[model samples]
Target chain A: MLQVHQVSHSYGGSGWRKSKAAAGKVLDNVSFDLEPGCCLGLLGTSGAGKSTLGKIVLGLQKPASGQVTFEGFELYTKGRQGIRKVRRDLQAVFQDCYSAVNPLMTADHIIGEPLRNYERLSPAELKRRTGELLEQVGLAAEDGSKRPSQFSGGQLQRVNIARAIALKPKLIVLDEPISSLDMVHQTLILDLLSELKDSIGLSYLFITHDIQAVMTICDRVAVMDKGQIVYHTDSPSSLPSAEHEAVQRLVSAVLPQHPSLRTSWV
Target chain B: MTSTHTLEVRGLQVRVNDGGKSLPLLKAIDLTIEKGQVLGLVGESGSGKSITCSAILQLLNRRGLEVEGSVRLNGRQLTKLPNREIRMIRGREIGTIMQNPMNAFTPVYTVGSQFVETLRTHSKLSKMQARAQAAASLAEVGLSEPARVMKSYPHQLSGGMLQRVMIAISMCLQPALVIADEPTTALDSVNQLQVLRQLDKLRTEYGTSILLVSHDLGVIARMADTVAVMKAGEIVEHADVHDLFDRPQHDYTRMLLQARLRGRKDA
Candidate 1:
């Protein structure tokens, strides 16, 4: 499990000294918990500090204040070994599937990179595990030989998901993973995320601007606006009724006035 | 103004030749936008939606693209027009708002100067008049203190602001048609709604027909009077928004609708 506690971060100030000019706070006392097999959704539009928070949680950037604990061990406070251990458990898949993977690397190699870093697997075993990862994501085994450009955007994202789950990580930060995809493909990716979580008991920190995507996949939703969580709800259906003006704006923007698709053919 | 049909297309086809063989990118296509109506074109990437828009604007000609068919703007055949004449109609008569706000703007110049230049290209407006028009256009998009925005460079503005500016400038000329190719796709939800609202306002006030090309079904459902679903470079189905969503005729259209509305509106 992952727990982020009162993490605050800022960027862009005049000097390095403590009494220096005030900086723009990208994250202000943000906190969240990811249960072992549940999904926690963070919904924020542009400039809402979601990405900044993602970086802080990933240990790519240290928050100015507060802390992140993975499996009850302080994340950033720990030294090299602790960082490495946490890295193995915390995975991420970003929006740009094309850039998320190296164009030069083959599909299986891309997935195997994480395995190679985190585990001590022989060449043959690594190859087999890579193939299994591809299959788990509903891709063909032959796809392992193909390059990133050879595969479509959706396939590349599948490969990224394969890479994320390569080590069987405890938590995967899905950062707008399907935003670049087409609608049908978006559905497929969301389906895969749900399947992966339920089947393998994987935890997800779902980060997206899209309300529809969150509703389809996340168990609990947290609405972040201007670097703070304005609304948190376990019931996504109740989102439209939230009192906060920010939440209301997002809800109106998300919910359609009429039914878009019919459940039954009637 | 007497013509109910603002723009028309008939049997539009695009073919690209790589090496010796020609590949059909867009099959014979037909669509129309009536006066003050929003015609939403929805499709996946490479569904030739953007290509269709380019074909309307006659932009594919630059890529040595072989385009076959008739594209008429208010009864004037655009495909057969000479480059010089078509250039005249490109922006002023048939305005465009593409996805990327940054690419649409010139980096070196202030936004006001760019607006003035764009306005003067098709119209014989004086510099002073163009300046006033540019500021007015900005304000029309709900940007307060339009003068400050005009003076600022494109980089100074946020993506949402720049996109609004794009919407503003597109409508400044009061063109008969506006082909917005994913105009709000790059912006966030708040800005997306704002842009959508602005486009709706344009239909009410200016009566400018819009060819809205977006992958978002939600956007199409909200903005469009008619919706055309495209796949593999062909229009699989075209119908009124209600019919398109309620009773999709094509299998692909049905699947797309199902994909977006797969689960409960919220889990």
Candidate 2:
């Protein structure tokens, strides 16, 4: 389980000068919870701080206010060792899989890095585990020997997911995982996520601007706007009943059947 | 509204040399965009939408690629034209708004300087004349302080603002055709809507035919007069916007339409 309580972060301005931040507040009083084995969709437009929230939760960035706790322990306050343990339980599938992976390293090294760090398996054992992870994410074991450029965008994302799951993380923060992919590829990745979640009992913080993809995969959804969670609801049924105007607009824009729904907002 | 355009493509085929082998990227593609019409090329990545636009401008890399097509603009065969002639036609007769605005502009030059330089290159306009025209164009694209934006560097502006600037630059020449490759893919939804509205306005005011490339079906529905659904380097379906949205013929098109996030509740 993961809990984010009243997290706030701002960019620019520092100390006594008190200048208005050029980029403004990145996050403001954001709070959310993720139960074990349940996917939570963080839906927002670009620049809505969804990724920032993920980073804060993952301990990549220190929040200016509030605390993040996992299973009753303070994530940031526990320091490096605690953070490392937290990271062992959590992993991330970044939006840009190409950049997330080192171009110099082959897929084998990329996937094996986490296993090498967390586990003391021999090189042979590491290779076996890497192959299994690749297979789990719908990639061939032989493909792990190749570089990132040799694979397509969809394949690269699968590799990324494979690496994330190599550590057997309880939660995977997928940031715009399928946005850059094709429709067919997007479907494949979505299906893979669903299958992995069902089998592994994994929780996902599915961050994306596209609502339709989230609707298909996530069990619950939170609509974020301007550094705040404006709406939260259970997926499938509660999405339609949500009161937030922004949520309604996003829902209407993504839906193919409702051409007239967001006309007034536009 | 359906008046025939000067632009025409026939039997277009593009092959890229990958590892010493010619890999077919697009096969025998045929497309036509009438004057003042917006044609949306809807497809996922590697769907040949970008390649088709690049071929029209003769911008694709020649070493690793071969373009075999009859691309005629205003009865002039673009494929037969030399680089110099193509350069002359480009940015003047045919404008382009690339996806990444930051990469499009020079880092050192101010927006004003680049605009003036671009205008001067295509037309014999004095610095003062070019500056005034550039400012006017920026205003037309919905920038509040056109004068201020002209003096600012590309990094000084937001992605949406820079995109508007790029649109402003493209509109300055008032080209016969505008090729926009995922223009609003980098922007927020609000900015995306704003840019789309501006693009629509440009078509109405200047009668500029547009080739809008994107994966978003909703965007195509909102702006395109006609839609071409591309898949695996081929145009699987082509129809009017209303018809394509109402009755997609191909399975892929239908799947795309179905995949679109729908309903107010999901928002």
Candidate 3:
């Protein structure tokens, strides 16, 4: 489980300020929780500070105020030890697969790097596990032998997901993981993520500006606006009931229903 | 609206030289945009949505790509027109809004100057008259300081600002049909909403027809009256927006509509 408590961050001075410490705040007193095996969709428009929260949660950046804890370790407080613990428990899947991983590296090497660095494994075992991870993410076993460029955008995203889960972290922070993907692939990726969360017991802090996305994949949804959590719902079905103008706008913008819904969902 | 039909394409085809071999990129695509209507062209990458737009705008032929078939704008034959005559109509008759507004602009020229130049090309308007109209249009799109926007270079503005200006410029000429190729793709959700709303306003108030191409179904749903689903260089389905969403005839359309990566809720 992960907890973000009273975190706030900012940059840029009002005028001729001596330091960024005196700069304007971008994130203001934001807080949320990621329950075990739960996918929490963090929804917000651009510049709403959702990404800032992600960085803080990942221990990549220290917020000017508040703290993020993974399991029992205070990610920002445990210092190097806390950071290392978070690394062992937390992983991330980025939006753009083309830039997320090294293009020249074969999918095998890309997924194997985390295994090689985190655990002591023989080349044979590493190679075997890479193939398994690729397959687990719904890619062909042999596909791991090809470089990132040799794969389509959706396929490369699968590679990225494979790399994220190679270490079997407790939680994965997916930052618009399928934004660049086409519709069909987006459905496949979402289905894969849901299956993974159920089978592997992985928690997802899914961040995106999309409303329909949260309604489909997330157990709970948090809507942010202007650096604050404007609305939070336990069931995504309740999102339309939210009174915030931002949430209303997002809900209203959800696309018309599709024929696929006849067999699947509302 | 006497003319319900604004733009029509019949059996439009395109082929590109792939390593010295001519490969078909678009397979006789056909669609129409009615006056005051928005036609949504939905497809995954390499589905020939962009190629369709290029075929209409004549960007394909200029790049040495081969095109065939017919595109008509209010009975004007766009495909067979001479290059000079087609050039005159491409912008003045069928305006285009590209995905990236920043790259669409001239880096050195002020946006105001560009607007004036574009307006002058389409109509017999003096510099002062064009400037006034451009500023007014900018303000109409909720952009403040129209004068400053005109004076500022494209780089000086944000994506949202540049997009608003782009919309302003495209609408200023009051072109019959606007071909917007992923116009809101580069923008944030808030900006995307603003742009879509402004476009919707144009169709209602000015009766401008728009060819809206995007991978975002939410956008297409909101802005489009009709929808065309393209896959692998072919149209899989075409229907009214309501019909397409309610009863998509093709598997590809259903897949795209459901491809938002959502999961079933436990509750």
Candidate 4:
């Protein structure tokens, strides 16, 4: 379970010192609640401060105001001990799969890096578990020896997901995970996320600009505009009725699946 | 325009010779685009869609790659044209809008300077004339403050803004053909819609032919008159957009359509 209460943030400021010279707030009094074992979709366009919010929730960046409570523990104010306790229970999968992993590291070593830090495992056991994680994400165990350059965009993302679910983390912050992939790969990745959620009881903070992606995997959807949650819906199917300019733009932008259904003059 | 057809490709083939082995990049392909029509090319990555564009543009490295085919633009043979003449034809006769707008522009120069330079290169317009033309072109693309956008550098603008700038440039000359390679893929939803609308406006207003290449079927269905599905360096299916989407002839195309994330669209 996670709760973000009136969290606000702006760039160009460091530490507890708030700079008056800082630009306008990127996130303005944002609040959300994610129930246990349920995915929360944060839908927004570029520069909507979606990633910044993700960083705040991950405790990688400190918010300017308000509180983020994850698993009944405060992320920022409770300091090092609170963060250290929850670090292993939270994981992330980013958009650019190739840049997320080190080029010099092999797949097995990349996935095993977290396990090594969190668990005390021998070399043989670590290798076995790494292989098992790869299999769980629909990748071959033999792929573990290859570098990031060897895999395609979709395959590399699978490796990234493999690493995220390796610890069986309670929540995974997926920031535009399928945006960089093609349609086929997008379907596969969405299906894998859904499967992982049902199998291991995982929760997700799914950040994306895609409405269809949210409809496929998320239980609830929140539409963010200019760093504010302008619309909130219990389900994605009801998104079309929202009157917000941002939501309407997103809805109309989704091109029809078949040419016969196309109404636009293009 | 001198020629009725804007672009025509006949038996176009491309191959790369690595050491002693020759790998085919594009098989013999045939395509044609009339004035004010859109031809959609769709395929997976490494399926020769981009290669086809590069071959048509003569942008591919000529050292090891062999392009064996005829490419005609408005009755002019592009494949046989000298570098000097083809260079003249590139931006003047045939425009291009690539996926990444960042790469299309220089970081140091102001957008106004670049637009003026591109305009002056193809025409005998004076500096002042080109500047006025640039502002009008930017305004045509729906940029609210053309003067501010022109003064700002490429880095200062968002991807959508830069893409609109690119569209303004490509359409300003009223080129016969425009090759748009994933033009809206990098943009957000609203920006993508705006860019697509601008492209459509060009076809309707200026009667420009467009070779729209993308992996997104929805985009193709909305924009293209005819669709071509390519797989493994060859076009497997070429048909009307409606027929291709409703009744696909190829298995690969069918699989791609099926792979699209399907859910309830109505409220």
Candidate 5:
């Protein structure tokens, strides 16, 4: 479970000044909450400060104002100790799988790196656990030896997911997880994520620019614009009727799946 | 004999020289784009879609990759042309819009300088004339306050803005064909719509044939008149956009359409 209360942030000039009214605020009074075992789709256009909000939620950057609480512990108020206590329960999967991992390390080592950080495991135990994680993401045990360059974009993303789930985290902040992949791989990864969520009862903060993906996977949807939550809905099914400018723009931009459905375009 | 098609490619093949052995990157493939037609090339990653585009444009390095084919743009053979001649034809007769617009322009130079340079390179326009034309073209693409945009550097603009600038540069010359490789992949939905609308306008107004390469089926379904499905270096299926979407013949094509995430019906 997570809660974001009036989170705001700004870059430049005010780094140490602690100025409340910074010139350009990246986030402005953004607030939301995620329930246990629920997926919340954070939808926004580019430059809408979605990534800044994600970093704040992940505890990578403390917001200048407001608070982010995870598992009932205040992350920024208590400083590093607050996150360190619940670090095992929180994990993140970024968009670029290649940049997320080291090119020199093999898939096994990349997944095992997190396990080594938290717990003491022998070499044999690490390899065994890595293989299990790989299989959990629909990868073969033999793929453990392959490096990042050796795997395709989809396969590399799968390895990244394997690494994220290695700690059995309760929540994962997925930032544009399938944006870099093709439709086939996109569907495959989304299906895999759904399976994992149901199987492990995991929660997700799904941040993306894709409306279709949000509609397909999210239990609840929130539309962000200019660093604020403009629209919130209990289900994606009701997103079409939302009157918010941001939500309407997102909905209208979605191309029909088939040409027959695109009668108005021509 | 005069060919009515704006672009034609036949038996195109690309093989990378890996040490002593050769690895085939693209099989013998054929594609044609008539005047004002949009040809969509859809495929998975590493399926040789980019290689096919490079091979058509003769952009592949001859030393590392061997391209064998006949590529004709407006009846002028491209594959056999010398580097100098290919360079002349690239921007003048055929233009390219890549996926990442940031890489298309130099980081240090302002957007206006790059746009002016490209215009002058392809045409016999003076510095003042090219600058005026550049601003005009940028304005045509719906960039509000073109004067301000022309004064700013490429990094100062967003991806959508840069992409529109790329489009403006590519279309200003009225090239016979434009190769747009994943033009909207980097943009969000709202920006994606703007880019797509600009492209559609060019095809309708200027009669510019487009070779649209993308993995997004929805984009292809809306933009392309004909669709070519590529799989592992081969064109598995090529059909009218409607036919391809409604009745996909190839197993790979059907699998691709099925993989598309359909919006929730309740919405």
Candidate 6:
């Protein structure tokens, strides 16, 4: 459903001060493909350009080079209206849920905003759809009346998810959606994502530094290092050769076992 | 050296007043850390890990917060000390690295200026001396060019580099104890490892005791000598790192470990 070829992006431009001159490239010749109904997990450190890639795919940022196509249609060539329509088909769950939704708006308004924009629905239908969306995401109907601040981080994230899927987008870019959450809440969010994907037959572009999270949610995984895809594997069992020094270090860093591993050390 | 127990906590409790009623944030708790040892405090949000640390540092506001029990650092009672004495000990005797490095630093000033200011506040060092020490500390924390970094603003550096700068600033004081509250939570995996490795090195070289607070079990396993599992403002289990991992008696600890392991296996 998605294809990106030889994309590159840098932060600064010419005529800047000497110290800021030629700011290093954030993404270098990045390429990837995502099939329909499959999750493509992007794993990278903070500066590894994971978010940058997500932004490019979402058409939020213009890539310095390379082209992005969605089902053979040029994403950038279509301009604003086409891009907006495409965006309605491609949703995103951002990292910070608290800021993702407007604080002044109630959950009903927040979740209903996308539906209102993308589809023409009467007031009664809008309210009904908002309630249903909230319920779908495991939230109560009463929650739609409350503001963003009244909920916890996990709950806010659920609201964000509800809004993202309100339009029933074909693809969802989950950008470190569970990073700020605690263990139990993290699991809950992951489970919710899985359930939503299955029920809606939606594809996911999961971006996170969390190797474990990627392993759990992704059908395929790609490890990005220094703005390049260092390894790509079809499944957890098919992880790139551990003999590769970088991959070996990453594997070791993940800490595969628990209590027994701890006890054995003692 | 002093006794093995560099810091001791006994029945520590914290309560915050909300709507004219006291809402207990931390239940009675006990903990101890030996010199050069790393202790991990693990919990979900609102579990009171951060509250406990804030209580120890006397950073909690008295207007809405109440603290009970005893906290001793190097045989001195932290709770009993007056604010002046506590202020004297804060940055000089006990350093802290908070979760967000960007929030911790000032955007208006260069990193060097902030570092010198921090040094001058606790010591009688001149600007040049403080600058030199700050550069040295930055270099020690793995900054490629400390001199250049010193002149750069906080926004000029990446999140990982900013975090490293925070670590440098905290350790430059040469405190006996360091309280790192999710120090690498905002960092990516590589930067996270870099920060943790640097912290490990700090403990080794300076014999500085560390209290590492995080929700990630993998992080706790790699860095902690002792592990304390916290839930809803209380310590559910406390033991040596190996024991806590190998034979977690508490169900919550086991669950956390299981979740962490399941995550690893899935990866």
TM-score list, all predictions:
0.92, 0.89, 0.87, 0.95, 0.96, 0.93
Best by DockQ: 5
Look at candidate 1 and tell me the lDDT of residue A111.
Answer: 91
Candidate 2 structure quality by residue, lDDT tens digits, B17-127? 888888899988988988889999998777789889999888988877888988888767889888989999999989888888899889899989999999999988999
| Model 3: per-residue Cα lDDT over A1-266, one tens digit each | 78898999986665555453543677999888888999999998877888888888888988998978889888876446788866867889988789999888889999998898899998889889998998899888899789988998999999999988988899999999877776678778888999999988999999998676788889999998889998888999788788889898776655444433222111
- Model 2, residue pairs in steric clash: A239-B265, A240-B265, A247-B267, A251-B267, A254-B261, A255-B261, A255-B262
Candidate models: Cα lDDT each: 0.85, 0.84, 0.83, 0.90, 0.89, 0.85
Worst 10 residues of 3 chain B by lDDT: B258-267
Binned by DockQ into CAPRI classes (incorrect, acceptable, medium, high), candidate 6 is acceptable
In model 6, the clashing pairs are A215-B267, A259-B245, A259-B246
Question: Of the candidates numbered 4 and 6, which has the greater TM-score value?
Answer: 4
Candidate 6 local lDDT, B110-187, one digit each (tens): 988988998999999998998989998898989999989999999889878988887787777888899999988887
**How many clashing residue pairs appear in each of the predictions shown?**
0, 7, 3, 0, 0, 3
lDDT (10s digit) by residue, model 1, range B1-267: 234478888899999988988999899999988899999999887889999988898888656678899888888888878899988898888888888889999999998898899999978999999999889889989999899999999987888888888778777888889989998877778889888888877778899899999887878877888988899999989999998877889988888888876755535
Worst 10 residues of 3 chain A by lDDT: A257-266
Residue A16 alpha-carbon offset, candidate 4, angstroms? 21
Candidate 2 residues A56-82, lDDT tens each?
Answer: 877788898999988666778745565
- Candidate 5 segments exceeding 4 Å error: A13-23, A263-266, B261-267
Q: Supply DockQ values for each candidate.
A: 0.41, 0.25, 0.29, 0.60, 0.63, 0.45
Residue B64 alpha-carbon offset, candidate 4, angstroms: 1.6
Candidate 4 has an lDDT of 0.90
Q: Which tens-of-lDDT digit does each residue in A1-266 have in candidate 6?
A: 89999999887655646565665888899999999899999987677788999999998888889988876666777455547557788889998899898899999999999898879999999999999999999999889999999999999999999999999998999999998887778888998999999999999999998777877889988888778888888885455454655566565555425434543211
lDDT of each residue in B1-267, candidate 3, tens digit only: 233468988899888888899998999988888889899999888889998988888777546677888888887777777888987887788888888899999999999999899999889999899999999999998897998999999987878788788778777888899999998877766677778777876777788999999987777767778899999999999998889887889988777755542433322
Q: Model 2: runs farther than 4 Å from truth?
A: A13-20, A235-241, A248-265, B1-4, B16-23, B231-236, B242-267
How many steric clashes does model 1 contain?
0
| Model 4 misplaced regions, further than 4 Å | A13-23, B1-3, B261-267
Ten contiguous residues with the weakest lDDT in model 6 chain A: A257-266
Better of 2 and 6 by DockQ: 6
Model 5: which residue pairs collide? none
Off by over 4 Å in 3: A13-23, A77-79, A258-266, B1-5, B19-21, B61-64, B80-85, B106-114, B120-127, B144-158, B257-267
